[model samples]
Target: METKIQKWGNSLAIRIPKSFAKEAKLDYNTEVEMTIEEERLIIKPVKYKKYKLSDLLKEITKHNIHKEIDTGQAQGKELL
Candidate 1:
């Protein structure tokens, strides 16, 4: 697919064809990551980050097992 960079307000934008957008699952407000490699530029949707509960717990435990509790900071806060 070929696209032309056109002027928009103060930025340059590319008009992607509907067919290409649909095949790539592109939509309004979709978050994308852009990168350049060699002589090519790449654009891809940003994937959600995943975390395993067990792995997170293990990391926290390793770093904070013997940490002192800060009771003063937690005492007067009203959590909404």
Candidate 2:
């Protein structure tokens, strides 16, 4: 498959085919890692580390204190 490098507002860009993108599971706003080697342009999807809420909360200590803000009246099961 061949694609054309077109002008994109003062920058040159290449359009990835929808079929290829779908096969590679690439979607809008997907982060990719691009590199050039031996005159070849390689684009790979960036693998981001997934973290759980519990893992993130463990990183927070007393050094960064997050104060709760009052959001007016309480509703349902909430204790005053």
Candidate 3:
């Protein structure tokens, strides 16, 4: 199917037809990863590997420690 790129506010946007999106199981709020190969733009849905917190914590050892990540400055009621 062919689509035309149009202006959307400050960015260019294209509408994926409903039939195509439905066939690919894509909808609003679905995350997609976009990459450019040679001269073509490829977009595909992001597949996330599910992990449980308990399973993740099992890999932590005594030598491992949590590092503080800077999340910018606190906003609203967030405590430092």
Query: Which prediction has the highest TM-score against the true structure?
Result: 1
Off by over 4 Å in 1: 61-66, 71-80
In candidate 3, position 16 carries an lDDT of 93
Q: Write the per-residue lDDT of candidate 2 for residues 1-80, one digit (tens) a residue.
A: 97789999999998889998998888999999999999998888999899999989998999986888988887866884
TM-score of 2: 0.59
lDDT of 2 at 34: 91
Candidate with more favorable, higher lDDT: 2 or 3: 3
Model 1 TM-score is 0.67
After superposing all C-alphas onto the true structure, candidate 3 shows an RMSD in angstroms of 6.6
Cα lDDT of all candidates, in order? 0.82, 0.90, 0.90
Q: How would you encode candidate 3's per-residue C-alpha lDDT over 37-62 as one tens digit per residue?
A: 99999888999999999999999987
Candidate 1: tens digits of C-alpha lDDT, residues 1-80: 56689999999888988887888888999999989999787888889979999987878756468777665544455554
Cα lDDT over the full model 3: 0.90
How does each model score on TM-score?
0.67, 0.59, 0.65
**53 Cα displacement, candidate 2 (Å):** 8.3
lDDT of 2 at 38: 100
Candidate 2 colliding pairs = none
